[model samples]
Target chain A: MKMDVIQPFINSADAVLAQGLECSTAIGSLSMEEEAYRRKGVAAMVWLTGDIEGRIIIDLDPETAVRVASKMAGAELPESDSLVRETACELANQIIGNAITALNDQGFHFRVHPPVMHMSEEGIKSSEDTEALVMCFETPIGSVFMNIALRYNRKRHADAASAGH
Target chain B: MEQFAPVKRSKDGQPVRYLIVDDSVFARKNLARMVESFGGHLAGEAGDGLTAITEYDRTHPDIVLMDITMPQMEGIEAAERIVQSHPDARIVMVSSVGYQENIVAALQRGARHFVQKPVKPEVLYEVIKYVLGDDGAVATAAGAGV
Candidate 1:
C-alpha cells in the first residue's frame, strides 16, 4: 500500500490512542505480513468500500482490553464484561473513522462500516495486491495493534482519469 | 468529567433535553456522561438513524447529537428528514468522520453543527451553548438563572 494511504491510519491511531488514554503513545513496531492474521486477544474489525477498499482490525490483549475499557468507563470492569468487547469495537470505529476523514480530504471517497468483533482465531490471508500492514502502538496502559489491508480501486481511478480526458 | 454551568431552556429554565444517536453503546455512554456534565438531560437514545427519527418524535428533545455512519440509515439523511418535518429542529452531527465534504453535506442538509469524535467535553459544551443561542441560558453557580 502507498504511504499516503497508510499514513492516515498511523496518525489517527496515535492521536486517538493518546487522547483516549489521556497519555502519550509511541509506535512500538511496524511490519508487513503476507500470512493470515492471528488474533492476539480482543479484536474489532471495520471494513471500507469505495475509492479505497479493504478492512482494518484493532486488536488488544485480554488484560489490556479490560484495563482500557475500565479506564474509559471510569470504573473497574471485569474481563468477562461485554463492555470490554464494546470498547475494542468503539476504538476501531473511532480510529478508522478518523483515518478515513483525513483520506477523504485528500480526495478519496469511501464508506466506513460499523465495527464487528473479530471472534475467529484466524483471519483472511493477505494477497499480493493487498498485503496487510501491522502496527503496534505502545501506550501507558498497554499495547494496541492495528492491521490494515487496503488497495486502491483501480477501476474507479481509471474511470476518473478517462473522464477527465 | 468536568462540570459546567447548567444550560437550561430560556423560556422555562428547565434542563435542556437531548437525543443522542450512535451505534456504539460505549460512545453513547461517553456522550451521555458529557451531556450530564453540562447539566443536560438525556431525553432519549437511539442506536441507528431510523430509531433516531422515532426517538425524536417520542422525546421531542431540544437538541439531537447524531452519528454519521450507522446500520440502517446515515446521520445526514436522518437530519434532513427530521428537519423536513420540524423546521426548528437543532441537529448536531457528531462523528469520527469529520471530513470537509461530510461536514458540508450535513450542514446543507440541516445539521446545525458538526463535532468530531473522541469528543472533548469542553468543545461539546461550547457547541451546545452556541447552537442553542438565544433559546438557552446558563445557570449561575448560585442557582440563579442567566
Candidate 2:
C-alpha cells in the first residue's frame, strides 16, 4: 500500500490511542505481511467499500484488551467481561472511522462498515493488490496492532479517468 | 470523570434529557457517562438508527446524541426523519468520522452540531451548552444538582 493510504491509519491510531489512553504513544513496529493474518487476541475487523476496498483489523492481547477497556471505562474490569471485547471493537471502529474520514477529505469516498469481532484464528491472506501493512502502536496500556489491507478500486479509477477525458 | 456545573432546562430547571444512539454498547456507555457528568439525564438509548427513531418518539428527549455510521439505518437519515416530525429537535451527530462532507451533510439534514469520536468530555459539554442555547442554563455551583 502506498504511504498516502497507510499514513492516515498511522496518524489516526497514534492520535486516537494517545488521546483515549491519556498518554503518549510510539510506533513500536511496522512491517508488511503477505501471509494470512493470525489474531493475537481480541480482534475487531472493519471493512471499507467504494473508492477503496478491503478490511482493517485491530488486535490486542487479552490482558491489554482488559487494561485498555478498564482505562477507557475509568474502572477495573475483569478479563471475562464482555465490555472488554466491546471496547476492542469500538477502538477499531474509531480508528478506522477517523482514518476513513481523512481519506474521504482527500477525495476518496467510502462506506465504512460497522466493526465485528474477528472470531477466526486466521484471516484471509493478503493479495498482491492489497498487501497488508501491520503497525504496532506502543502505549502505556499496551501494544495495539493495526492490520491494514486496502487498495484503490481500479475500475472506479479508470471510470473517473475516462470520464475526465 | 470531571464534573461540570449541571445544565438544566431553563423552563423547568430539570436535567436535560438525552437520547444516546450508537451501535457499540461501549460507545453508548462512554457517552452516557460523559452526559451524566454534564448533569444530563439518559432518557433513552438505541443501537441503530431505526431504533433511534422509535426511541425518539417514545422518549421525546430534550437532545439526541446520534452516531453517524450504524447498521439498519445511518444517523444522518435518522436525524432527518426525527427533525421532520419534531422541527425543534436537537440532534447532535457524534461519530468517529468528522470529515467536512459528513459534518456538512449532517448539519444540512438537521443535526444541531457534530462531535468526533474518542470524545473529550469538556468539548462535548461545551457543545451541549452551545446546542441548547437559551433553552439550557448552567446552574450555579451551589445549585448544581448533579
Candidate 3:
C-alpha cells in the first residue's frame, strides 16, 4: 500500500487514542514483517473489500484494553468484561473508519466489514506474498500494535472506481 | 435526586433527553458520557438499529445518536423507520464511517446531522446543540475537545 493509504491509519490511531483516553502516543519504528507476528492479549480484525482486499489487525494487552475501555466509557471496566472486548473492536473500527475516509477523499472506494475479536495467544499468521507493515505504539495506559496488509488491484478495480466519475 | 424522565430538560431550559444506538458498547457509553457532561440526560440506549426503533418509541427522547453500521439493521434504515412514523424525530448519526455516500444516505433516510468517530467531546456537544436548535452557552461549554 502507498503512504497515502497507510498514513491515514497512523493518524487515525493517534487521533482516536488521544480523544478516547486523552493519552499521548509514541509510535515506534515501522518495519515490514515477512511473517505475521505472534498475537498479544486482545486483537481486532477488520476486512477491506471492493477496491482493496486484505485485513487490518489491532493488538493490545488485556490490561491496556481494560484501561482504554474504562477511559472510553468514563468508568472502570473489569478485566474479563465483554465491554472491554467491544471497546477493542470499536477502537479498530475507528481506526479503519478514519483510514477509509481519507482513502475515499483521495479517490479510492472501499468498504469495511464489522470488526471481529480474537483473544487467542498464538498470535496472527501471515501468508507468503502478503507483506504487512507492523507498527507498535506506546501509550500512557499501555502499548498498542497494528498490522495492515492490503493489496489494491490498481488496474482492474481502481480504474473501474475512478471511471464511474 | 429527580429520576431522569423521557425528554428530560436541563436547568437552562434545553431538552437534554437522548437515546444512543450503536452496536459497540464503547461507543454508546462514550456518547452517553458526552451527553451527560453537557447537562443532558440519558433517556435510554440500544445496541443495534432494530432495538433503536423500539427504544425510540419507548423513550421518546428529544435526540437520538445513531451509528451507521450495526447488526440486525443499519442506522439509515432505522432512522427512516423512525422518521416515517415520527416526522419530527431528531436523529444524529455518530458513526466511524465518514464516507460521503453513507452521509448522504443517512441524511436522505432522515438523519438530521452526522458526526464521525472517535467523536471529540466538543464536536459532539456542538452538533447535539445545533441539531436540537439550542445554540446557547452549552455549545461553548467545552473548548477542550476537538
Worst 10 residues of 1 chain B by lDDT: B137-146
**Which pairs clash (backbone N, Cα, C closer than 3 Å) in model 3?**
A38-A123, A39-A123
Which residue ranges in model 1 land beyond 4 Å of their true spot?
A75-80
Name the lDDT value of residue B146 in candidate 1: 48
Global Cα lDDT for candidate 3: 0.80
Q: In model 1, what are the clashing residue pairs, if there are any?
A: none
Name the weakest run of 10 consecutive residues (lDDT summed) in model 1 chain A. Answer: A72-81
Clashing pairs in 2: none
- Per-residue CA lDDT of model 3 for A7-93, tens digit only, reads 989998888888777878989767887675668668898988876678888988878898888877767767776766777799999
The interface root-mean-square deviation of each model, in the order shown, is 1.2, 0.9, 3.1
Tens digit per residue, CA lDDT, model 1, A1-165: 899999999999999988887889999999999999999988899999999999999999878987887777666767764777888888998899899999999999998888989888998888999999998999989999999999998999899999992
Task: Give the distance in Å from residue B111's predicted Cα in candidate 2 to where it truly belongs.
Answer: 0.6
User: Which candidate has the highest DockQ of all?
Assistant: 2
Q: Which residue segments of model 2 deviate by more than 4 Å?
A: B144-146
Q: Each model's C-alpha lDDT?
A: 0.91, 0.91, 0.80
- State how far residue A51 of model 2 sits from its true place (Å): 1.1
